[model samples]
Target: MSPLNSTFFINDDIVHPDFFFISGLAGIPHTNYYYIFLGFVYAVTVLGNTFVMFMIYSDHCLHSPKYIVVFNLALSDLCGSTAVIPQVIDTFLFKSHLISFEACLTNMYFVLGFLTMQSFTLTLLSYDRCVAICFPLRYNDLVTHKSILLIIAILWMIAGMAILIAVMFISTLSFCKSTVVNSYFCDHGPIYLMACNDNTPSAVIRWTHPVLILWLPVPFITGTYICIARALLKIAASERLKAMKTCTSHLILVSVFYFPLCFTFALASIIHRNARIINLSLSTVMPPMLNPIIYSLKTEEFTESIKKLYRRTMIHITVRKK
Candidate 1:
């Protein structure tokens, strides 16, 4: 048996396996500690993202085009985390690894779909920053609440359709050879590679999905910043510093979100399964937890809104005491 193939999945003959078994962190000692850690990560992700959404919703000052993208990113983070973490806990910790065919497709859709939206949203943010830095006079006209919302909606549909097609393609595959999915979840690569037949289309998607989600966005963001840099050089030192300051949080976000996945993909074949799983999970959940914190701390507008909300809460409590 090849090192890559799971022993339990090696000799199966069901043309369309009704369910697939999730295999990850099984042979490792103290694996429960890992799942427990995931629980804590999920909690922080939920609270942090929810509060960011709340801040955007309640503050009229935040009702601008930029905040609309911020809200969309927060929503994508929350939904993406919810879709992934609970399933990971249920499958690995609870020993309920049997995922039905329909459920598996559903899982693939939400996990990959929202992840796609996350990349697209970040690209949209880059566009926002590009315009603001390059064309300050036309910022209000080029970027509007309505226009931003429309772009976000369009991106959501594009992501959904792309993932939906991938899911449908998976449905056509004949998993006659393996039912053991050797990953933390029903990850596309592990599942598709196990198929008995020619999974040519799935293989295409396997590469293209990453290109669409990571490669395309990273280069675009890098180019966006290059343009921003050019624009900044044309300005005075003080104004340039202030404009660059607005990009600090986003740069951190792009780093945390993409770098791990890039590292994993680069070393996937050489690394242990457990190591890849941990890397992928972090690349998935860490951004959702850190994004809101980064924004609230680094973005001046969000910081001011947090102060206003805190003051309002204190005043409400005082009035109630009286």
Candidate 2:
């Protein structure tokens, strides 16, 4: 057996057959610590994203197009975290590393799909902000509620179609050899690399899709922000502060979303495999938990709404008790 091929024995008869085995954070000491930490991270991710979505849904003041985009981003975060973290916890804490072929593919689909959705949503949000700041007089005509909804719908459609194409190509491949994935989750690279058949199409899709998703939007968003900054330069100090405040949270989110991803890919060549896996896993969890917190802290409306909701809940509780 090659050094790369790690064998997992099942009973006496089955010896490292073609079964999916997740290799999570190998060579890490004190895995229980990782378990507890990741459990907390997952819990926070779920609760934070859920609360953000609820805030967007319940608060009438937050019915604008920007907040609607935020709500959808929260929804995507919720879904991506739910799809990944539980399986990670199971694999790490419960020693349940074996995943079925069908389940792995399904997980892969949602993970990639939600990630694409988030990228597209962020791009749309940047464009929305650009229009609002650069052409305030025409922003209303350019980005109405109906138009935002249409853009969001198109975003979902495009993301779904991309993933569906990749999934269809993946489905046609054969996994007759080693099915052990050297990562915590069923990532496209790791899983597709395990295929024994021709993976040229899968490789092309996997490589090109991420480039298209990440590279295409990044320059546009950066340029939009640059324009926003230039536009702010001409305004009064107070107005400039207010406009920049509106963008700060989103800029933070973009950093949080992209920085780790970029770093992970850049360091993959030099970092230890175990460290890379650990970094990748944490990257998946950290942004979802942090996004809502950034929004709540930076956005005055979200904070006020949260306070109002708290007050109303307290008053209702007191009345019920009395």
Candidate 3:
């Protein structure tokens, strides 16, 4: 068999077949490590995202446009992580990696859908911060509840349409002889390697997908953030300090999530072999793990809310003991 056509499975698991030979440490086995580490990550991801949803739903203080967008983002993370991580857990625990073709397509759709929505939401957030800082006079008027809702609706619609178009393009191509994916999931990276056709459409997806999802958003966010920073620097020292305190965390997060993501996917078409897969997977996975930590942990309100909930539960338990 051609090297491209040859694939190996992890203990006969029905996995992404292309991942079997990925180099640069991607396909390296962490047999025991992934089980323990991913289990912890899965628990935290599920619980933390759910808690954010709960906080948004329950807290009257979280009803503002900023929090509303955050709530939507939490929901997106919850959905996206859910679609990928459970299969990961099942694979490790049950030794069953046989994902059917239809199931793989469904997982691919949800992942692309939520990841696209996340890009748009992050763009929306940067613009929100820009107007809030650089044009304070119009901030409230520009970012009202109704307006935020409209923007979110548009983002969802756009993301859905984009996923639909891309998946349609992918489905038209045939898997033919090779059907094995090598990654933990049916990530596009692994799928592209196993594909039997000319891969012209896949090449288009590699370029266009990143442009649509990452490149288009990164500039707007980065430029707006820069403008906001410059505008803040011109103000009085105290005001500049306050704005920095409020906005610095988000700027850090935007850089972390967008820059690497944009660079990785933009270059995937050139080097999607196993060696590149490791780096790409790390870049893709880190954003979902870090986003909640950056936004929620930095917010005093969320921290305080969690503390209060803990104390209240403790008190109820104490009383129940009596």
Order of the predicted models by TM-score, top scorer first: 1, 2, 3
Per-residue error for 256 in candidate 3, Å, reads 3.3
Top-TM-score structure, candidate number: 1
Question: Can you write out model 2's per-residue Cα lDDT over 104-169, one digit (the tens) per residue?
Answer: 778888988988887788888899889998999998899889999998998899888888888877
Model 3 ranges off by over 4 Å: 1-27, 189-199, 266-275, 304-322
Each candidate's number of clashing pairs is 0, 0, 11
Query: For residue 299, what is the lDDT in candidate 1?
Result: 98
RMSD of each: 3.5, 4.2, 5.6
Global lDDT of model 3: 0.70
lDDT (10s digit) by residue, model 3, range 108-144: 7887788778778778888888988999999898999
lDDT of each: 0.88, 0.83, 0.70
Per-residue error at 20 for model 2, in Å?
0.9
TM-score of every model versus the real structure: 0.94, 0.91, 0.81
